[model samples]
Target: MVGTSEDLHRLFSFYWFLEAESRNTRSREWAEYFTLIRTQIDLFTMDKFDEELVTQSREAARSKPLKFWSRYRISGGALA
Candidate 1:
């Protein structure tokens, strides 16, 4: 479902509403992709993200024709 940056952002935008539904987003690949996007989107929307930060991230988010940053891998830490 999420193949490009625009796709990712849309998924991220729909994020909170999706979470409220308790529905799986069909594919694990897309789901993981959206998770990262969600974090970025959340940061962008949040006051702490800042204008400068948002500007940089927005540019990055637009520039990268991300073919799914989801290799089923996160910057490892604890599993939830």
Candidate 2:
């Protein structure tokens, strides 16, 4: 289980990467892998980590506009 904010941040980043990859590839295998990872993350947060910290880390990862833009380029700067 993750024990610190840094670890949570790393996990969230990985989660984001997996999710993005699953979307970009449109593969069932990647989608399943992302779902498994998400389940593990949820279990860890519920069983061993602080809820607030997990929430904050998830929010931080989701709110990174630069990361989003770099990973996915949309026409006319629209969101993906």
Candidate 3:
């Protein structure tokens, strides 16, 4: 599945809450069960694209004249 890392983290957080609530019960045996499910799930994020494109854009901006750098804005890890 594809989603932002924040969403994925939130999903795991919910699982943790469920585990915590069931602590001391037979259900506790399923603690972190999502971890096992995650092992079989393929997840993808735009982190690599942002790291490569945005980082390079920022570096290139640093080398440009101040006027050029100021002409464009970097928003959401993208050149805008």
Instruction: Give the Cα-based TM-score of candidate 3 against the true structure.
Output: 0.30
TM-score of each model, in listed order: 0.32, 0.68, 0.30
Spell out the clash pairs found in candidate 2: none
Please write out the lDDT profile of model 3 over residues 1-80, one tens digit for every residue: 34444444444344333333344334434544634443332222224334444334433433442342233332222333
Output the TM-score of candidate 2. 0.68
Q: Give the alpha carbon lDDT tens digit for every residue of 8-61 in model 1.
A: 444443554334223445566666666666676666555553455445544554
Q: What lDDT does candidate 2 reach at residue 80?
A: 53
- What's the alpha carbon RMSD for model 3? 16.5
**Comparing 1 and 3 on TM-score, the stronger one:** 1
Look at candidate 1 and give me any clashing residue pairs: none
Which ten residues in a row are the worst by lDDT in model 2? Answer: 68-77
Model 3 segments more than 4 A misplaced: 24-80
What's the residue-level lDDT of 71 in candidate 3?
39
List, residue by residue over 1-80, the lDDT tens digit for candidate 2: 52877667766766676666667655687678878888898787767877788899877766652454346522233435
